[model samples]
Target: MTKNFNIWFKNFHAGIVLKVDVLIPTKDPSKIRPRLLQVLKGSDWVGEIIIETSKPLSRARVIGARKCSTEWIAMFDDDVEIPENWFDSILPFIQLKDILAISTPSIDVNNVHMIAYKRVMDHFRPLEQRDAPFIDNTLIKREVLLNYNPSPLFYSEDELLYRYIKKHGKWIHPPSCGVKHFLVMKDLVKAAIIMEQLGFYPLYKFLRSRVAYFTISILAIGYSHTYKTMTFFWKSNIKLMAGFLKARVNKKGII
Candidate 1:
């Protein structure tokens, strides 16, 4: 349970500005660093920029987060394009005593798998607060992450943190603070493989999320007449399920 506090969005004093440390966990910092710099240039709340190039992204995030000096840390993926006003837009959430973290939405996203996955997720959590952590562009407490430090897994580390915070308090999804994801079907597929390999993610949630997700995709294929779109959806799901099954088989030592 969180303690009650007065809303401070209106009382945002210009002189007493609170800055946030920005952490970008990516293997390709050479390419993404300048891009991130350009995107975050306009923000007043941005503090130190920590770019970690560790092999496993989760490990990189943990390293960068620990280096943060502010009360909050803004963790972003290498690929997404963040809105300039994002930090200020989510200030209301930052002021909330009950809030643990805030994940910004991926707007104007074109990827077939992401669109399909998010559409299905909408039914489950309509406020854009997903069942799994969407940490692509998120504002999180520095200490909270250090306390429940994410593992060095290639994937599903965000899920681990999500489950931990969901029990303790709220993780907000503010629609106004939007980002653009430049991810593909291949990424999710690889993530699924790594997720199974890691082996600690909740099996029930995985089964339920994937089952309902691809079921909707299959249903869409049967009913929809949009040839190009449905075909793309079909191909993406094939690779996705293939990765999952391959991971499953590998995990069971059946290969």
Candidate 2:
């Protein structure tokens, strides 16, 4: 959470008109509170920090939304870092009348192929099928959230919200505004597993439609095994490779 606060402050300070609310929902408040306090010590933009225990991600978001005092709220994951002038580029879009939500671009720091894969996959998804990019990194109006209740059962709540907004209001993604995503190779494998477990099997199949991700995952695993000789790293790489392989076997069209 402190990590997110630092990144948000560094990349998103404007001419004092903008106010920010940083909401953190974690299962262990005791472990995170001290660190959060240290991070929030001198911040001016932050309005509130909401902490919850043992709640699912979607429910945590709803809890955070209820605590927000401002008209606009920006959701973000704890690990992401917004590049400089990120807010400057997207400020106009946020200020637009009738816009319910705005999503900026996200770039991967490691495994550049992952970023390419998302663009290719997202581009191909039907507008109705596509969700707002990353929920944590997107900006939303309080009114939109007030009107809609997020379902904890959905695998991708961000997409669910985006689809709802598209149905009832306006949703936009600007070309210039984006975040730099730092994804360790291990995190990528864990993400694949979580997605599959959460019912994002369709995305897994779509990304694995060609030999590109498959070959990359395999070669990445092989290289890690042969050169590093670290069992943990090797295993993580293998896990990602297995995910791609599983996708090949499933081969179902996108849901």
Which model scores highest in TM-score? Answer: 1
Give me the displacement of residue 151 in model 1, in angstroms. 3.3
- All predictions: root-mean-square deviation over Cα? 4.1, 8.9
The whole-model C-alpha lDDT of candidate 2 against the native structure comes to: 0.56
- On lDDT, the leading prediction is 1
Model 1 lowest lDDT segment of ten: 1-10
Candidate 2: residue 197 Cα off by (Å): 10
Give candidate 1 regions above 4 Å deviation. 1-11, 33-35, 108-129, 187-190, 197-215, 218-226, 252-255
Q: List, residue by residue over 120-204, the lDDT tens digit for candidate 1.
A: 5566566464454777888888877777756666556677777778788878887735677777334767777776676644678
Residues forming the 10-long window of minimal summed lDDT in candidate 2: 223-232
TM-scores, one per candidate? 0.77, 0.57
lDDT of each: 0.68, 0.56
